[model samples]
Target: MSIPQKLFSEFLGTALLLAIVIGSGIMGERLAGANEAIALVVNTLSTIGGLYILIEVFGPISGAHFNPVVSAVMAYRGLLPRASLPAYVVAQLAGAVVGAWIAHAMFDVSILQLSMKVRSGTGQWFAEVVATAGLLLVILRAPAARVAAMVAAYIGSAYFFTASTSFANPAAAVGRMFTESFAGIAPASVPGFVGAQLVGAALAVAISSVFAGAPVATEIEPKPNV
Candidate 1:
């Protein structure tokens, strides 16, 4: 595919993913009526389904990389062209913001607002690291056809297991900063989350390289896990 086409896929996929995330959070929060656990469960299930569908829909066109870390890893492994990394990252970031705005619009909320939800601390950062590392490991190791299912399943599980609720994607962390909702993350907290995610991604890459006995050699890469 051409660079423009690939970028569009990345943008659209990311936008829809964020919409599913933020929109569901809003809906779930309202419907759960003070039940935080119930709201999270609803949000988690919707995200799992949305993520699986988006990956399957766009993976063939652009590898469905909606996360900057995933694009970076793919480029490092030579699955994606190094020159295209910037475009992919930009697309994902732009799509993320747009997605958040779209979600806010759908729910008749203020658009372009920053999150006030302060998610910080050692345990949260460490949880992000573990979540992101586990995510990358699953993506790197899953069979091509099973990438979507495995990734969605992992994120679903991580939602409950991780302290940060597993905002494992840097683009996702950035996106969530635009909403002041249940799934939102404070803008001030984004840097720490992103930093932890990058570290986790690096660790995953190193482990994958070692397990493969070298850098991955496949020309066709699997879909990015969230």
Candidate 2:
């Protein structure tokens, strides 16, 4: 797509993705009573559905990279221009804040709040590393036709398996930090989560490069503007 169109798609896609995540968490927490597991299940399912749709809708435009780390990896692999990385990151981060605000508005909560939920420690950080690595691996390996489903499935599965609920996307972490809902992560914890995610992304790229050769065209589908 054209640069403007690509950036717009990324912005909109990431906004919707964060809205789904935070909104679902708020809804689930309100309805699940004291059952944290039930709340998580609802959140996971909704996120999976939303993720699938967003990827499908935007993949043809900006390759649907709603995460800064993913965009960085793509640039490193030569699938994206290095000069485009800053725009992608800026769009994703801005979209994340907007998405969190929208979620709060939908839930009738204060828009001016920072998460107080403290998520840290070696185990949680390790989980982020593993979660992010697996996410990138799946994206790298998925066929063009299956990228949407595979990515959604992996995130859904990671939610249950990973201690940090698989906040594999850096933009997602930024969005969640702005809220005080069940999905929110304390602002203090964001740096750690984001750092771990970046390390994991780098590791995934290294391993994939060793085994999978150079990047493939499946990274994105053919688009007229692109």
Candidate 3:
């Protein structure tokens, strides 16, 4: 498939994700009312479910990356072509912005809420790195392990636990600026988060390549303290 087609897929897929993000974030914020854990749970489930659906729907066209982090990792590992990278990023970002707009319109809320900022300290940054790393690692190494189920579950689960909600896609990270709800990423913070996610994805690409030719390391089994 052409990169443009894939890029379009990313655009649509991420739009769907933001729609969910906005709808869920607003509902959760109102329902949870300062309960961080509940808000987190709601956001995670929405993200996981939305991603699962988007990947299935968009995979045939653009491999449904929906996330720049995923694309960067895939490209780093030779799964995606270098030429298509820029197009994919542009399409993904455009889609995200549109998606955020629609989401805000649907809820009849101020778009500024779409640009809502979260207080991130050291813990959040490290969490973003770890979360992105896990997501990239699973996608990169899955075929080797023959884990048929890992494909969707990896991303879904990563978003559930990731502090950044695993914004793993730079475009979506930028697009999310449209919503000021719980899922929103401030314009100012987008670059930093995106950079960190890229770093995490790049590391995964290197690690997967190192293990590609060599067999994936397996542990020796001892008879459970028998």
Candidate 4:
């Protein structure tokens, strides 16, 4: 694919991902009333479905990496050109913010609001580390054909298991910071979450190197322009 096509793919995929996450959270919260658990279930189910579809649709175009950590890992492993890393990260981050705005527009909420939801502390941070690490592990090790399903499934599971509800993606953390909705994480909390996520990503790289042997070639690998 051409550079423009690749960037657009990444931007659109990441934007839609945030839209699914934030939009579903809003819808779920409104429909579930005071039942937070029910709301969470709804959010998780929507995310799982949306994430799967996005990966399948965009993987062939841009590797469907909506997260900076994933992009960085791919760059590190030479799956993606190191020279392209900055552009990829910028695209993803911009997409995330736009996605949050899109969700707000859909729900008729304030588009410029900042998240006030506090997500902090040692347990939550630790959970983020674990959540991010596990996510990278799955991405690195899962077969190409099964990656989309496996990733969605892992995220759904991590939603309940992790204390921070598994905001494992730094782009996601940044995006959610823009929303005051159910899925939102306060700006104050973002740095810690991002830091923990980076740690988790590094850990995953180390662990996968030992256990997964060489990186498994996948359908998501970027193809050269014809």
Residue 55 in candidate 2, Cα distance off native in Å: 0.2
Model 2, residue 204: displacement in angstroms? 0.2
Q: Would you give me the overall lDDT of model 4?
A: 0.96
TM-score of each: 0.93, 0.93, 0.82, 0.94
Superposition error at 125 for model 3 (Å)? 1.6
lDDT of 3 by residue, 1-226 (tens): 7656777778888788778876777778888999977987787677667766776677777877777777766676678887787777777778888888877787788655546585366656766777677777777665543332465566567665666666666776787776777777777787778777777777777777777665333433456875
Superposed Cα deviation of residue 217, candidate 4 (Å): 13
lDDT tens digits, residue span 1-226, model 2: 7999999999999999999999999999999988999999999999999999999999999999999999999999899999999999999999999999999999899997799999999999999999999999999887878889999999999999999999998999999999999999999999999999999999899889887755566655678994
lDDT of each: 0.94, 0.93, 0.71, 0.96
lDDT of 1 by residue, 1-226 (tens): 8889999999999999999999999999999999999999999999999999999999999998899999999999899999999999999999999999999999999997899999999999999999999999988988788899999999999999999999999999999999999999998999999999999999999878778843343545788999
- How many clashing pairs in candidate 4? 0
Tell me, by TM-score, which candidate is best: 4
For residue 95, model 4's alpha carbon misses the true position, in angstroms, by: 0.3
Which 10-residue window of candidate 2 scores lowest in summed lDDT?
212-221
Worst 10 residues of 3 by lDDT: 214-223
Candidate 2 stretches with Cα past 4 Å from truth are 214-226
lDDT of 3: 0.71
Highest-scoring model, lDDT? 4
RMSD of every prediction: 5.6, 5.8, 4.0, 6.2
